[model samples]
Target chain A: MILLSLLGISILVALIMAFIGDWRFAPEVNIGGSLLTFIVSLVLALQVYHEGGSISGSTYFFVDYLNISLVVLTTLVSTTTAVFSRRYMRVEREHGRVGHWRMRFYHAMFQLFIFAMLIALVTNNFGVLWISMELATLATVLLVSLYRTPTAIEAAWKYFILCGVGIAQALFGTVLLYFAAERVLGAGGNALLWTNLSRVCAQLDPTVMRLAFVFLMVGYGTKAGLVPLHNWLPDAHSEGPTPVSAVLSGLLLNIALYALIRCKALVDGSLGSGFAGNIMMGFGLFSLLTAAFSMLRQKDIKRLFAYSSIEHMGIATFAFGLGGPIATFGGVLHMIVHSLAKSATFFSVGHAAQMHGTQEMAHIRGLIRGNPAVGWGMFLGVMALAGMPPFGIFTSEFLILTATMKDAPYLAPLLLLGLTVAFAALFRKVQPMVAGLIPSGQKQLSAANIPVFLHLALVLILGIYLPGFLANWFHLAVEILK
Target chain B: MAHTLAAQINSLLAALILLSAFALLAQRKIMGLVHIFAWQGFFLALSTAVIGFASGEHHLYISSLLTLGMKVFLLPYILYSLVHKLKIHRDIEAVVNIPTTMLLGIVLVVFSYHLTAPIRELSNLMTRSTLAVALATVMLGLLMMVTRRHAVTQILGFLAMENGLFFAATSATYGMPMVVELGVALDLLIAAFIFGIFFFHINTTFDSLDVDQMAKLKETD
Candidate 1:
């Protein structure tokens, strides 16, 4: 019942947003709706935790240990991005970069996007999962093109085409999966349900499952922004509004990986082999190295962070690919901290870009001298992202590295090389921007820095202390994945 | 006897679908591409209905109707009007020459057939024979996207890929759940709508639909 209501509330809010999204208080509504979602997800999380097992509300939807935390993280980051966008978009409006109707479209689409992602998280049916993933892409495509500039249009087009085609492969994979499952489950809607398929996964045909996993990996891997398929990531992140970038990096990528991991669990059970894990590890390491080197040449701050997101996602994917209790625990923790830190980073970057009226790193100098809050926010957020200590990222990266050293010592040096190169690249770009001379006519804007600090504080707290409940939750999730 | 007839018809439609995919690859004229896409949709619908009749999977009948309504009629109408409204009904320039693209498409078809061979051997369904063709159509659609610079042609390629997926679903498993089929159909319609809106946006912003001209976003050295 609660799961139904959560989805119901999101859809209702999306419909309401479509109507009243042009109002002056629409941003407030977006934030309120997201907060309510977060609260309900917390309620759902408590219910799941208390039950200590998966809850299948219906054949259509369910809540498991695997998805409950992601649900909460998604809603939390969305609420913060909403709060940040309230001010950021208002400034854009004041500058005449956005019109009222587009604002309405933006608000409505944002809620709808959240709804699609929530569906992808909780849905039991693989087909519905694929559909919701595609829906999420469509909703965000409009948002990415909200400004409708030549570049924005191009970015949105590339995103649409690449993800569209990539996701189609996923659909083919789904069909193949259905083909494999139908023979065992006897041809009905039950064949498409994750719960049903996983229960009988071992009975499935290994050859067919292997083929299906290849397509599923390529399909979901594209959305997860794994290397080679990650061309759309930096472009979409850099071209869209900063808040969209935040969610794209922080939340959407997690949802995609969530789908991939879910599918991997099924394939592993079916094949009883490490084929899927090997593939994920290969892609993960390659993406980590590629994005790290690519970050060295980035001029746009958002693009730089976008590359960083790929790197972190690469790390998370790699950890999950390693597939032990320790690595899986680290992967889940990385998902949590990366969402918090990356979204927080984008929050600060959004403000800094708005203040300077440009996203160019060379032009956005003296942020600390001009606006200490945003400057320090950017500095700290990037530090957290670069895996500095006293941040949750450090803990997660440490867990990942130790696991790598123990499990696959040969890959440890390459991972370290990627991390070090990325750290150096980030500092080289962010140092002057935060501390150099203030540009002429640079004035302080009343920035919404609370969400920034709030997220950072959470990361800080999480780094210092993994509360008993969260650690327990991560352990349960790890066991479930294995 | 009835099953054999249905299988034969399904195979013929599958061959036609593959031929149309190849035609879509070689066609330069926008109008012709749209028409060929509709024909591909027509063949897919026929194959689906034949599978439904032979297997008595009543739900697949609905899927066949959906393919007919959306792909053969509704989507083609949208693309037709979009091309007319945009006044872009001219020859599309391929990033690679058409001959090379056709050769590449042939390679993709061969690869897909090789890839699906194991699954084909495992499948006992009457429609199993068409699985490779379905996969080939998907590959050809992807190849179309890669070789064409025109945004409209890319959309066509995407729709063709979807057609192949639907065909795969029907051939391999009769169909997905009714709800999922409906959801996918709705998604495709909405995708078409969004693609239409983007065409206008792309046209206005770039004054042409050639995607290569919009190269303003890259790393500045």
Candidate 2:
């Protein structure tokens, strides 16, 4: 009932906000809807906690330990994004970069995007999952091109075509999975249900499952912004509204990885082969190395953070690919922390960009000198993201690296190497921006620093001391995934 | 006798779809690609109807109708209007030459047949042989997208690829669920609209619909 209400309230708010055409009420509605959904999702998480976390309602919705954790993380980030967008988009409107009409569309689409992702998370049917993912893509494409600049259009088009093609391959893979499952579970709806298929997965055709995993990985991997398939990530991130970039990096990419993980669960259950993990690890390591190098040369600050997102996602993917209890725990923890840290970074970056009037790294100087709050927020967020001490990311990264060293000793050094390179590249670009002499004529800091500090504070707390209940839940989720 | 007759008819229709894929590859005019794409859809619809009748899977009849309505009529009309507005009735240039593309398409067909051999052996479905052809059509569409420089032609290739997928679904599994079929149809319509909107933007921005010009977005060395 809570899950249904959450979806209903989001869609309702989106629909109501569509016709109002009033900017003032838009954020109120947007934040209100997100807050309601978050509270409801929190309640759902508690219910799942007490009820042992694996519950399916009929054929459509499934909430397991993994799904509940993701649901909570998604609602939390979206609510914060809604809060941030309220201030950021208003400034955009004041500057005439966004008209009232566009604001309405943006607010509505933001709600709809969250709704679609929620659907994707809770759905048990793979087909519905695909449709929900497609809906999310369409919503984000509009958001990416919201500026209507030529470069923005180009970015949106590339994102659409590449992810579109990639997703079509995933559909083919899903069909193959259905075909394989049909032989064991027998036909109709049951064949495609994750629970049913996973129940009898061992009897499935291994050859078909292997082919399906390849297609699913490539398809969803494109959305996850994995390397080689990640050509569109930097452009999309650089061109869109900063809030959308935050969601793209923080929420949507993680959801895509969530879908991939779900598929991996089924595939692993079926074949009992390590083929899926090997492929994920190969893609993960390559993406990590590639993004680290890519970040070294980035001229745009947003694109720099975009590459960081790819790198962090790669690390998470690598950890998941390693697939032990400890690694899974670390991967899930990394996902949550990365989402918080990256979005917080973008929040500060967004304000800094607005104040400086450009996203170019060279033009912006002494963020802290210009505006201490935004500057300090960026500093702490980047520190957390770069795996500095006393942050959740450091803890998660440490766990993953130690897991890697324990299991595959040879691979640990490469992981360490990639992390080191990225660490150097990010600091090289960021340190001068934050610590230098303040640029003249910089605007005053906007009060939108709440989401940033709030996120960093959470990361700080998690880094220093993870709550017992949440840590327990993370362990349970990891067990379920393994 | 009826079984043999249905099998032959299915093979013949699948062959027509393959031929249309090749025609799309070889065609130079943007308008010609649209016609070829519609023809491929027509043949796909025919094959689905035939298989539906032969196998008595009644849901496939609905699928055939959906394919015909979306692919044959609605999409081509949308693309045609787009072409008319853009005023690009000129010949389409290939990034790769026509002869090479055709040769590659043939190689893909042979490869798909080899790849599907095991699945084909396992299935006793009436349209099993068409599975290889469906895969080939999909590959050919992908190849067309790669070789074409024009945005409209690339859209055509994507639509053709989708047609091949529909054919694949019909042949391999007697079609996806009805709900899924309807959802895919809706998605195709929305994609067409989105592409149409982008085409206008692309034309206005660059004063040309050639996608190669989009490379200006990357940093110049």
Candidate 3:
């Protein structure tokens, strides 16, 4: 009942905001609704923690240790984004860059995007998952092009076409999955349900499931921002509103990976050949290398962080592909920490861009002099992201690296190579920005840093001492994956 | 006798569908491509109805009606108006020449047949033989998308690819669940509307419908 209300209230508020046409009240509604949803998510997470297993609510909705963790993560980040956008969008509006109508549209569509992602998370049916994911894509496409610049439109266009094609392949793969399951479960709703399909996963036709897994990998992998299929990620991230970029890096990519892992569970159960893991490992390493190298050439601050997201996703994917209890645990932990640190980075970047009056890294010099809070916030976030000690990201990356060394010794060197290059590239770029002489004609702008500091503080606490309940959740999630 | 007759008609319809895919690749005019696309949708709807009738799957009847309503009547009409509004030129810009694309289409048909041979051997459904045709049509649509420089042609190719997937589902597994079918149909309609809006924006911003002109977002050093 709580889950249903959460989804329901989100959609209802979205519709209300969409039709209200009053920009003044839109942010309040957006923030209020998202806060309530976040509280509900925390309640659900506690329920799962104490109850210690799957909680079923009818046929369409269910919560388990695996997804409850993601549900909580998603809601937390979304609530922060809502708070962050309040200050950010106001600044945008004051500059006449955003009018009343655009603000209303942004508020409405932002809520809808959250609703779509929550729907994707809660649905028991794979078909519904695909539909919700498409909804998420469409909603974000609109948000990405909100500026309506030539470049923004170009970014939105590429995003729609590439992801549209990739998702179509996923649909075909889903049909193939249904076909494989239908032979055993017979035709009906039960044939497509994840719970029923996973129950009978072993009996599915291997050949058909093999083909279907390939399609699902390519399809969902595109959305997850895996390279070779990730041509749209950087462009979409850099061009959209900074808060939207934070959501994309912190939440949407994670949701896509969650979907892919769900499919991977089914495919692994059916084949037992380890082919899925091998393919994932191959893609993961390639993406890690590609993203790490590409970061060296980035001039746009947002694009730099966007490439870092690709690198982190690559590491998470590689960890999961390694497929041990330790590796899975590390992967799950990495996802949580990455979302926190990356969103904080974007929040700081948003304020920094606003202060410097440009997104070009070359022009935004001496951030510590112009504004200490934004400069230090970005520096700490980047340090956490670079896997420095006493940060949550370091703990997760360390675990991932150790697990890789234990299982695939040869691959560990490549992982090290990617991480070192990425770390160096980020440091070289950020050092000058944070510590250099203040650039000429720079003006300091007072902006809210509450969300940024809040995220970083949580990440810091996670690094020092992970809560017992959260650790237990990660372990349970890993077991579910195996 | 009835089984043989139904199989013969299914084979003939499948052939016509494949021929239409080829014709779409060969056409050089935007208006001509739209016409060929409509014809392909017509053959797809006909093939689907025939297969549904022969197999006695009642929901496929509804599926065929959807294909007819959306593909044959609605989408083509929308595309037609989109072209008119954009004042698009008649020439359908191709990144690759006509003969080469046609040749690639043929090669894809051969590859799909080779790929589906084992699956065909395993299945006993009446629509089994058309599985290769369905796959080939999908591949050809992808090829068309890769070879076209114009936004309209790429959209056409995408729709054509959806048509192929629908046919594949009907032939391979007697179509997806009715709910999924309806949802996909709705998605197609929504995507078309979105693309229509996008086309106008692209034209106004870049002053050309050629996608190559919108390549201003490159990685900077």
Candidate 4:
């Protein structure tokens, strides 16, 4: 409860500070507040360990392994990114790319974005969750169009219309789920509660549950940036502020997946595994293959990373869909690793964009020669993203491949093929910028953010050594998934 | 006797909704399109109000009032003013010529009735046949959007589509909660204002209200 309070209040405090109207200290205040919140959450995690399993709420909140794990990821990344954006945004201001009021607007929207994500994660009610996700989408839409150029506006408009329709579908699907549960539970509002639904999931009609999953997946999948529906992701990422791209890929995508996984649990639990798994596997493979090939032709830097995010999400979905302890655990680890690595990649990409004056690969060259910290950091981030050995993605991907190979031998080949295709595609785009001769741009002050570096380091360390306690928690969480 | 009265009223309202969809499709003048759209909204509000009274759900009553105020009264008024302000009384450049659009609109009505057949079976007894009518209104509204190139015509189509959705809710479930209805009503009104301003901007930029001109704004190598 203390951790939850801190996590929730950090956003409030950040919101308060952003409105303080002193541009310099507002971001600092936000960062410091989130850091304090992080420390508090860490303490609460330790206490949870001491008590051993389950500390739920009276109403509208829960702290089971599933959400508690997600909260930790969300808050930790959010705090780090807040600290990172202070430096990142200040650099932009110094460069004259953005103005003071716009800075305030950015800070305000940033805090609100975090607040929305927290609400979506913690809210037990499906209606509240739907509303929170809408809030998040709206906040990010504003951020995506911050530049207000024709292209940015076009991107934001496309995002708004498509996602508006998608969220409406989710809304109708949610109403249907309520209708499905209402008859069984004799509903007031308990029919709409996640915990309550999970508890009585077995009693619900399988046919209704199965149909609901289709709506939930297609609806949430649009937000998750799954290809065919992923048209918005690359554009939004390419066009938006970089910190937002980081959060969208790292946090927002995960949030959508988390929602789907919750829905998947309901469907899987009710109808048995095979029915849901078949569709999940199909969508996952389709997304992975599409992203793999899509990355091959990409020239825009942020867009390249956007496709990689999709590929990783596909891997995570494939893992959970494969349905085993090892696979589910692997999926969770991949979620965490990819979040950290990809955020770091964006941080570097943000810096590289600042340095190069353009997002085009043709315009950027020899990042290492230009600024070793950001250059090497981007290279390392790319290496990690491409699932290189001795990185967290590698461990997670390996676990997934191994688990699939052992259980569903047919899926293993597809997984391997997709992985190889992704690796090649990423490297093909990555090599030119990271290794070539420096193009024409003045070398700027390199403050490749310390938090981003810290994130990369933590991922590298975890790849080499999964902390015993964290592993235990993931395993326990996987058990909960089952 | 009461059930028969309720069924007759619902069937009448549904018929009005379907007829307006046809009128919207066949209407040539943009001003006529706006008028037909307002008429559709009027039918929707009437149907929902009737459903609310029949069902005894007070929220449905509140929703019907909102549907009336926004969709029928305020929205049409705004569109009329926008039409006048933009001096856009000329016939909209229909994406398909009028006769073909009407033919297609008829096809959509038939298709909608087919689509709503199963739904009609499990529907509220009073609203049984209205399901097909509501679906037909929805398809006709969609047809209005598709075959119209003018921004004002497209807005008419969108509003008409909402009228269909409102009618569907009434026919299927007696209506969505009052709060949701009000929220959507507010959203529609606000959207109309925003889109109207956008239309004005588009007109000034391109010197035409036709969306085909905006295609030139799209990316080209």
Candidate 5:
């Protein structure tokens, strides 16, 4: 009943906000409603008791160990992004970049985007899952192009093509899986059911499942920003509003990975796990290598960090690909830490970009000199992402490397090489942006910096120590991440 | 006689797809590409329908109608109006020489046949033989994307890729469900609208729809 109410409350709030559209009050109403939704999601997460073996209604919505984690991560980042948007948007209005009418649309669509992702997370049917992802694509495309600049429009279009093709490939894979499943169960809509498909996997034809896994990986791989498929990531990140960039990097990418992991679970249950992990490991290594080297060439600040995200996602993928209990646990932890750190990083970077008046790394100088809060935020963020001690990323990366050395010793150095290369490249670019002389024309720090601190603090505490319950949950989720 | 009829129809279907692909290869004007794309859709619809009649699977009929409506009539009409309004009615020169493109296309066709033959053997669908054609269409569309300079042509290439994918689905497995087919058709419609709007904005901003020109905006050298 509460789940239904939570859904109802979010929609009702959105509907009321849409109809009212009081120009001045839009942000406050939306922000307050978002806080309400976040609180509700927190309650929803607690409702999912791990020992009870998952709670599902007759409807497609259910709380699994996998998606409940995503739901919480998405809601937390979304709420933070919203808070940051309140300030970023107000600045846009003051600067006359966005008018009142468009702000309302952005606010509404932001809500709708979150709602779609949550729906996508909870959906048990594959068809509904595809539709939900399609919704996310449509929503984010609009957001990406919101600025109406030529570059923004082009970036949005490119993002649409890359992700559209990816999702279509995913659609083909989904249909193939459906076809394979239907042959075993002998037909109809239920063939698309996750539980039903998993139950019947042993009897399904191997050839179709093999082909279907390829399509699924390629399809979801594109969305996950795997190398060679990551062309749209940096452009979309740099051109869009920074909050959107934050969520795109931190949240949407994880949801896409979650989709692939779910499919991996099904395939592994059927085919005994070796082929799938090998492919993920191959793609992961390639992505990690490419993104690390790509970072060395980055000129724009957020673009550089966007590549870092691709790199971290690669590491997470490698961890998942390694697939023992320790590795899978590390992968999940890496995702959570990456989300907090990346979003916080972007939040700080957004403000920094505004104050410095350019995202070009060469133009901004002495970040610490001009503003200590955002400058230190970036420093801490980069540190955490670089996998240094006392941050959650270090522990996760350590766990993954140890696990890799034990099971797949040959891949261990490749993992270390990717991590170290990325670390050096990021600091090489970050030094001038942080420690040099303050550049001219620095605008006053305007956007709220609290969200950045909050995110960093959470990551800080998690690095030092994880709550026992969350660690246990991460371990259990590891089994399926295999 | 029945066997000959079946072979004749399958060969005709193959010939029609290849002819349209050839026309698409040589076609230069944005308007011309759109027209050829619609014709290619026509061939696909015809091929799927014939495969349906030959195989007696009722699902392919819906797939054919979807191909007809979304591809032949709807997408062409949208592309035509989009280019007309944008006033870019001139022939677009390919980045790669046309002959080279044509040669590359032939290689792609041969490669696709090599790839799809084994998979085709696994399926009982009689349209299985056309799987290679379907794959070639996909490859050709990708090549078109690489060769074409104009944004409209890129969009044409993307739509063509979808056409190839649809053919693959129907020929391989009788078609996706009606609901999914409908959803894809709707998505294609909306995608076209978004792309069309983007074209106008791109044209107005940079004063041309040539995608390669926008490479000037890349941040890193």
Candidate 6:
């Protein structure tokens, strides 16, 4: 019942938003839809907790401890971002940056994007997963170009072409996966179902499985913002509206990693050689180091956080690659905390950008003096992102570090270096902006600080004390992964 | 005898598909690139039909029809109207010289063959031999994207790559599940519509379709 509601509400909301999206109350409708979805997801979490295993709602949808938590996280962040977009986009209209048509388009596409993500998360079919991921991309490409500026168009174009080509490779990989499964499952739709494949994965051809995993890694890794294919990540995140950036950083990257990790489990089962895990670790560590260093050079505040997203995803990916109970636990925790903190930072950054009328960090001055609410919000959010103590990120990062030290002792120093560099880079840019002299005649916008503080408060609570149920949830998910 | 005949027709279609991928890489006129892409789609449909007949999988026939309609008729029409409306009839310049691009294409073909050797050795399917050609076509399409400068040509390269993947699906496993094939076809249609919208947006914003002009988004000092 919860599964059907989750899908029904998203589709119904998308349709309703498409028709009435230009109206003044459209933002409220968007918020209502997201809130309803969040509530439904919480119900899903409760059901999964009570059930204590995977639930096959049908042949089409599957829910387990792993995705139930992610579903709740996705809907929660989306709801908060919806609220933030209400205030932020209104200010944008006053500046004549977006008119009614674009606003309608934005609202409709936001719901569709969420729908695509929800489908991607719950679908039992790998083919459906691929299609929904592409749907998410198509829905967001126009959103990225919403301002219709030259640079916005360029960013959207680059995002479309790069992700288009990269995702095509993933289709090929999916084809390869089906090819390997066809023999074992006797050539039909049953071959593409994840549940069936996992049960019989050992009987699947290892050579074909290995090739398929490599293609799946590159294809999904591109979406996950891994290095070498990560050029589109910063441009898409920075150029889009701040709410889009929030979800792109906080939620979309996790979905891409989720797809990759799901496929890795099958490959690991078939090969029994840790081949998939090693490849993930290599890409993970490389992305971590590269993005950490890249963060220092960013002039745009959103881009700085965008690169930090890549760094954190790299850490999660690396943790999952370690392929043991401890590291996988750390990885899952990192995903949750990073999503909360990063989206909160984008919320603060969005309001800060509006106040100063720029995204360039150099021109903005004295955030605290200008508006204390937004300033302190930005400070705490960035601190959380930088993995400082007393924040949830610190706990997750600490767990990952210890896991790395115990398992891959040689790689610990490199991880420490990346984390340190990212820490310094964030503080150096963020401190002055928060504390320096207030620029004269800076008009304070009525900012939305609730979402920002709400997210941070949750992160703080998780940092100090993780409840037993959530811990049990993570442990169960890790078992499923192994 | 019927099985051998079907395999023969399949290989011939595969060879034609690969030739068009090469043609796409070497074609300079935007109109010519679109024509080559259409021909590539036709050959892919033909190959899918032949594979279906040989394997007795009725779903491949539907996939073939979908490909023919979307790739051969609808997508090309969209591309044609876009080219005509945009009035970009100028010859496209390759980033690398044509000869160098062709040499690279040849190298990629060889690499694909080597990559698929193990699979060919293990599989017993009639379409197994064409697997290398499918992979080669994919790589060639990627090469086309890299070498071409025009936005239209890059899109053509992308479409050609999708054709290659479809061919791979048909040749490797006869076809994916009917539902997946339909979903993929729908995605292709949506993607084409989006690409069309973007072309106008790109043209209006930058006043040109040269992807090179879109360099304002890099990092700063």
**TM-score for chain B considered on its own, for each of the candidates:** 0.97, 0.96, 0.95, 0.91, 0.92, 0.97
lDDT of each: 0.92, 0.87, 0.87, 0.76, 0.80, 0.91
Worst 10 residues of 3 chain A by lDDT: A20-29
Error of 4 at A140 (Å): 1.4
Q: In angstroms, give how far residue B152 of model 1 lies from its true place.
A: 0.6
Query: Which pairs in model 1 have colliding backbones?
Result: none
TM-score per candidate, in order? 0.99, 0.97, 0.97, 0.85, 0.92, 0.99
lDDT of 1 by residue, A1-482 (tens): 99988888888889998889989899999999999999999999999989888999999998888899999999999999999999989888998889888888898899999999999999999999999999999999989999888889989999999999999999999998998899999888889999998899999899998999889999999999999899888989998989999999999999999999999999999999899999999999999999999999999999999999999999999999999998899999999999999999998999899888888888899999899999999999999999999999999999999999999999999999999999999999999999988998575678889899999999999899999988988999888787
Docking class of 3: medium
Interface RMSD of each: 0.9, 1.6, 1.3, 4.4, 2.4, 0.8
Residue A447's lDDT in candidate 2: 46
Measured against the native two-chain assembly using Cα atoms, what DockQ does each of the candidate structures obtain, in the order listed? 0.84, 0.52, 0.63, 0.19, 0.34, 0.87
Give one digit per residue, the lDDT tens place, for model 6 in B1-221: 98999999999999999999998888888888889899999999988998888889888889999999999999999999998899886556545588889999999999999988888887799999999999899888888887776889889999999999999888888888998989988888889989999889989888888899999998776
* Clashing residue pairs in candidate 5 (N, C-alpha, C atoms within 3 angstroms): none
Identify the superior model by TM-score, candidate 3 or candidate 5: 3
Better of 4 and 5 by TM-score: 5
Q: Deviation in angstroms for B28 in model 2?
A: 2.0
The model with the greater DockQ, 1 or 6, is: 6
List runs of model 1 lying over 4 Å from the truth. Answer: B90-96
lDDT of 5 by residue, A132-179 (tens): 777777778878888888788778878887787777678767766776
**Higher-ranked by lDDT: 1 or 3:** 1
* Model 4 reproduced share of reference interface contacts: 0.00
- Candidate with better DockQ, 2 vs 6: 6
Query: What is the Cα root-mean-square deviation between model 6 and the actual structure?
Result: 1.1
**Model 1, backbone clash pairs (residues 3+ apart or across chains), number:** 0
Error of 3 at A5 (Å): 1.6
> Over all chains combined, what TM-score does candidate 2 have?
0.97
Q: Listing candidates in order, what is each one's chain A TM-score?
A: 0.99, 0.99, 0.98, 0.96, 0.96, 0.99
lDDT score for residue B73 of model 6: 96
